[model samples]
Target: MSSNKITLKKIAEIAGVHRSTVDKVIHNRPGVSDAVREKILRILKEKDYQPNFIGRALRNQENRKTIAVVSSRVNSEPYLHQGIQQAVQEVGVFGYDVEYYIFDIEQIDQQIEMLYTLAHQKINGIILQALYDARIPGVVSDLAECGIPVVLLNFDHPGCTDALCYIGQDSRKAGRTAAHLAKAFLHGSGRIAVINGYYEKILNIYDRCSGFTAYLAEIAPAVEIAEIVDSSENAHDLYHAAVDLLRRQQIDCIYATSSGTEGIGKAIGELGLQDRTHIICHDLYPEILRMLREGMVWATLSQDLEKQGYLAFQYLVYYLLKGIDPPSKKILIEVDIRLKENMPET
Candidate 1:
């Protein structure tokens, strides 16, 4: 058979399989055995066969496709809720139905269980922001075995076999940026205290802290690290800790690796260190913005929440629809550093 004249029917005949089987293999659908699928694929490659992927995608889109979004609940992270909402809107335009399974990242077992339930529902794809779990790779592997594509949101599942991709910012760079802003505001000589969220569990927070300290060590060695505090995502605890640190140490700068600005700002206010101490933090949450405007917080690193959510859904749709793999294993979003001087008029 001429390569130029190759067709699905001709390929099916050459492979000694039904045209339906060829169709399934061409679209990467399961039910065909691995050996047989490989054989069919080999023959197609030999013939230089190009399937009508666009037509197939159009027909598939006619069916109501289901994509599951698993992330932290709103109370855990209101910013994530904005992302989830954006994702839903973006995917809905492409005729993909999204179902959200909100969970607390602190509840690792419950989050894992929800993943199992979604997989059991035979979801076409899953967008997850998983809590720290050693068993996550196994769970992702199980879903892969069942032919479900998984895209991680705001985090990456490195070494997970067949995990699709991660969508989020370059955390280390954001941290380094925070350090730059802090050093400039403090004139390169100040005692800095680091405030971070669940540093052991959340890799991003750790990366940010690492990046900030690394930069300071390289460039602003005079800006000393007075102390490091892990808030464990508790505002009250962070406030008390911040107050204690302020009262004891001459903390001229605060580098917060997470979104607990409200509590940190309160501590700075109580100590009347609002003008004396310069604080840098992450995210543009309402409270953080308020602090920035009030001159309590110096700068914030924003990881465009809406764009993260929109792109997460968009990439999954591309994979499930056009059979395109993620452009890369990890997509690093641009970090927007917002400060009072350049605060956008919302």
Candidate 2:
């Protein structure tokens, strides 16, 4: 029979074995003897039989699989949401369901509580945007012990060795890239004011700042980081902080490692410092894009938030459905630098 027409029933009949026995051999499940298993395998190899995954999925619909995506409702949430939605559309037909949860970035206790809640609910797998808390490793380990796999998104914790993989941009490299741009814009000898959102709590932001400072120290020693401030990712707070900093000191540039670039732009525009002050920030929020167009911001570094979300969900689904692990422990997404000329059309 043609390979396309071959079925487990036909193979079982040819081998004179029960269909259940054939199924055991096909799925590598225990119960069949070695001799019968070898015979069924021979038939399968000779016929080039292929399992009907869609049919298997349909049959398994009574026990649907669930994947939970937990993240902070930060500036990049919309792009990440789009990616997860696309993955759901592709995987929904295969008896898979996704539950998405967004929490405030500052609420670490709430996030920890939600993790325990999902574990109690017996979620099949999880995709998480981990924070830089000491409690995370133990929580992830407990989830692994419960037979739930986790894929870390955006931020990674060094202690979470039990996680399946981490999928996000290399924040250190992005920070180094930002430093390079700052050096070029300033001719390697200017004072830059650094603004970060929750820098003490977020791992990626911390790494980005580390990289930025390290790179400048190695190559652009003349580029001085005059001040580093934490503005908590709030636009109004960021605005007030930026205004205070710019008014207090003659900053040649502003490098923001988190969201709320609008605040920095407003501070510069209102202070009439746009001609003198360069701004470098992360992500491609709508306001940032507009600022780039009007020359209120100089350059911004962006990563593929959608792709990060899509792969985190897709990898978890692959593991839950097929027992496959991601090929690498770290799946690093590329960082793209955006300027006004290269900005996407609105």
Which candidate ranks first by TM-score, i.e. highest?
Answer: 2
lDDT of each: 0.79, 0.85
Candidate 2 has a TM-score of: 0.83
Q: Which stretches of candidate 1 lie over 4 Å from their true place?
A: 1-62, 74-77, 90-94
Which pairs of residues have clashing backbones in candidate 2? none
Q: Point out where model 2 deviates above 4 Å.
A: 1-57
User: How many angstroms is residue 51 displaced in model 2 relative to the true structure, after the best TM-score fit?
Assistant: 11
Please provide TM-scores, in order, for all candidate models, with all chains considered together: 0.79, 0.83
lDDT of 2 by residue, 79-184 (tens): 8878877887666646677788888877888988999999999589999885688999899999999999999998889888999999999999999999999999
Residues 175-238, candidate 1: write the lDDT tens digits: 8898888889888888999998878777788899999999988888898998998876667877
Model 2 misses residue 97 by how many Å?
0.7
- The positional error of residue 119 in candidate 2, measured at the CA in angstroms, is 1.5
